[model samples]
Target: MTTSASDKQKSTEPVTKTENSETVTKYSRLPETKNSPVRRNNRRPQKSFQGSNVSGPIFQYFMTGDDAQVATTPTKKRPSLGSLSDVGSSFDGELPEQSPRKMTICEAIDEKFSPVNYSACSFTSIGLSPVKHDKDGTVRVPWTLVLEDRNIAFAGDSDTLCKYCGNVRDLDLSHNDLQSWSEIVKILKEMPHLEQLNLGQNKRLSLSYDFSTLVQSQYTNGEQSKAEKPLSNDSPSTESCPGSEVNDPQTEHDVQKKPPVSLPLTLPSAEGLRGHRDDFVHTSLKTLVLINTGAPMDTIAQMLPRLPSLEELHLSLNGYKQIENSVMKIVEPHSRVKTLYFTDNHFSDWRDFAKLGHIFPKTKNLYLACNQLPCIDISFEGVFTSLESLHLGGNKLDSWDCLDRLNELQSLKSLRIHDIPFYANYDPDPTIRRSLCIARLKNVSHLNGSAVSPDNRIDAERFLIRHYLDHHPKPQRYFELVDKYGQLEKLGEVDLSPIEQICLQLHCSEMEICKEIQVKPSITVLQLKTCVSEIIGIGLKDFNLFYKDAMMEEAFGPVGCFSELKLMSIQLSTAGLCDQSELHARTISRHHNAQRQPSR
Candidate 1:
């Protein structure tokens, strides 16, 4: 195979998911020509197997290269397929001469597939087969391939994708037509060792004239329509809402068969998830993705506690315009969720984040990119304290104050800020923008998609310090930031005032002790008073840097930073009377440790 310069890739762009296919490393366009028989006939996996909970397994993602080349990099190798050689004829490494291909069937998959290489193994259909206890896949393979619209027959709980891949950790059932939540649970009962589940693009429920939905829809739209009042739950049919039963016999029978839901939200409880017949609850599953499923946040929220082992929950592109009451009940300050994603949801307000203080206590990664978020307020910082990697790209965030707020999130180490409105407000200089963002997020290891170099960080911080010092010099944020990150290397060195050593003799009868302390030229009387309080074992309100000299008050008063005239006189006195420079700890003997607010 001849490889061109363009075909030989150089850069190491890590794993990324596009809107369409779920590639392992990054999105690569498949062979677009019609003659490329390897191109997928059906849609690609509807969602990314978002690998936030990275403990159990890494699926050998089979990606298609530009030359109809199937790129398969398997992390783990399963047993060899030598036993079922009699079932199928031995073949050389080449694709079958069929359009959709003849190798896709589940029975045909008995012992042929291996993780090492599957480039020529093109298949069109996967069948429903009961799991076999026979050794080395006599009737069943460990992993099964099933796609939604790929002419695969998935007949309820008996779907072999669940039964065969039961003990395996990660499972992707994206683009499947698993319609009802009940049907999904039936499938879930089989996968005992599933560590991750991706159930995107499922058949959405067609609900209509429902009062709870009407009220919620009205609330989301900022106005109620014809239905202002809620109907009583007691006055109900069996179809999820009152008087909403379908006229068809199958629909009516199905409705009548189901119990009436009294609650306004369509969320299922733990009890509902596992009825009396459930064999086991899957505590091993860690990550759950429900992208584009159209399930309400409340419904998803209700599903949280039931799945106690979940570490990451992704619900992207769901039509949630607002995080409302029912949603807040389960999400805020509650959950074992370590990484949560609400991408493309258009959730804007930051004030509501206050309720999420304890949510995801151990959460390290968070992705909320591509929303209509305007700004991240100061109060919002505490909510994201536990995050390590945060994605806030493509939001409407439009201010520098948000940078200050972001800095307050102590544990944050990675940040993505692409297409933010703040960048739009500034001149289109990417270097300046990148430098400022790096400086603002001092602890960030990675910015956008690249690593933050130490030299780059130093330079960025230097630029940031200069930028701030030139604009707003003496702000407390400056002092605090400088104190933390230090003066930005040699390029931006902070200068300090000249200092002198002062020997002060305490007037205690025990010993003639003199304590040497460093004093700056512009040191304050108030600061001296506080120092005296610490040294003399006197309360702050009682201790005083008292000087009987009448003119000292005028000298130390708030005209400048300190009493300049008194300091000059002290300097002169120090030069002439160089006799160990003993200065007594002056006090009102009648009223020892005499200090006050100086009469305001």
Candidate 2:
């Protein structure tokens, strides 16, 4: 085959053409198209691509002669950009930009809490079961939002939260990916009326940042609601109240110059505060549950001042070994919390509890259940002066001295000390253990949630008095009750010998027939009824069995078939009686003679 003069002058590449098809035999150029004019060879091009980056075919040619093409190296075609329908205008094919898919807190809330996801009385979300509520039930409003295990990491914007969850009162953000206090504050500062917050089981959470500085930064950026500016001289004035700020000229200038000083004064309303206090304080949050969040004492101390209005603080399951001494120095700002739950922790020393009472001086109710407390210390008696209720269940306390020390809590009204070694090993019976607690604590009106009535108090005190009658070094409460009840006599020894036989009297006033029967102690009421059936000549179901007490004069009927008849005090009646299950038959002494029928 022959090539054109232009192709020969352009390149030395081999060209071969066959009669059947103009094709290269081996390593030769084929017939190029008539429109192809660009030269092609094995050599790579050195020209740089310098255009608007619009992608198309790599090689273009305009041929003028026979349809013969040169052998060119194969180049990988660039991957096509996927559909960009969502990308408005800025995204071009050049930079290969990719937007991250991380979910923000507001998007999570919206996706999980939108109206379309709600049914008649329930709402559903991803990776969670549906939350249900009733119109007229305890949950009258959707004021609580639980976003536990939602994998939320970033706080996007407060404006979105304000639009959706503006009135939210309780928020549960447990088991999420919130890494810092700033993210939590970003979310909390939007809810002006939030009351309870549960951040349980979150990993890598820290609340130890300077909250005052955070609040100041948020306010400086105008991200937080601007504090109400002081009334200008030109503004109309209302009636002045007592203790209102006096407009002194120097103080006015100072307030105008120092914007930080005026921030607290401007937050007079709940909406104004937005949990943004200058001194690391939140006014509306009353309960904070931080169970198993791995927060330490330093973190707690740092957060306490921020939660000034927090009344119930649940710090359970955090593996706290002891209260840090640093807590002692930081107690002044956090002492007003009234209820604290430190249950399921690792604290064993009562000195730590003493430190708790010192840290929270006004704590009224304390729950330290499921801990490893071994004993109560003397220091504990005086520290919890205002404590009204205490729960020490599931502890290691084994000594009676702990009980005595607990009695020193003058304001203590209710006490729970179950599952302790002292009771589990010594008493074993819950009834006796409860009586012992009621008898020991003088001011305690409730023991393990049951009220201590006057009769219960008397019986418990007498039992306690007899309990320690012969024991050496009796409890101090024993002496106190002994003085009140006047040295009660020791209980007589109980005769526990089983009876071999019992004598029962049977009388039917309608038939004027009276008889005396002797039966073995092992006979049940059903066997006694069968024996009576043979005597009275009546079927077992025709007449009901009743036994009337001779001393108490109270009649009981419909006795249980399996009850032993040996201990029953028997008197006869002919008429049918009502159910008297409450009245039980008591054993009569052998000396009491039955009124037998005279000889007919």
Best by TM-score: 2
**TM-score of structure candidate 2:** 0.55
Per-residue lDDT value at 354 in model 1:
46
lDDT for 516 in candidate 2 is 72
For residue 79, give model 1's deviation from the true position in Å. Answer: 38
For candidate 2, what is the lDDT?
A: 0.60
In order, candidate lDDTs are 0.52, 0.60
Best by lDDT: 2
Model 1 C-alpha lDDT per residue in residues 352-423, reported as the tens digit of each score: 444444556667787788988787754654566677888888988888777778777788888898888879
> With candidate 2 superimposed using the best TM-score fit, by how many Å does residue 242's alpha carbon deviate from the native?
48
lDDT by residue (tens digit), candidate 2, 1-600: 987889765554544456666333334333454665434554332221111111111112211222223333223332342344322113445744432223455445534532322222111122212322233211112578887776555554444444445567998888776655665665666676889988888655633444344445433433433222222231112111111122458845664565443354221232333444543356688998888887767767656765668899988888889987876665444566999999999998888888887778889999999999997765555788899999999999989878888877889999987778877677568788778888888888988888999899889989998888788899888888989887777778998976566666676554455777776646556676778777777666555555553333334333322232342233211121112321122323334424342545
Alpha-carbon TM-score of each model against the true structure: 0.47, 0.55
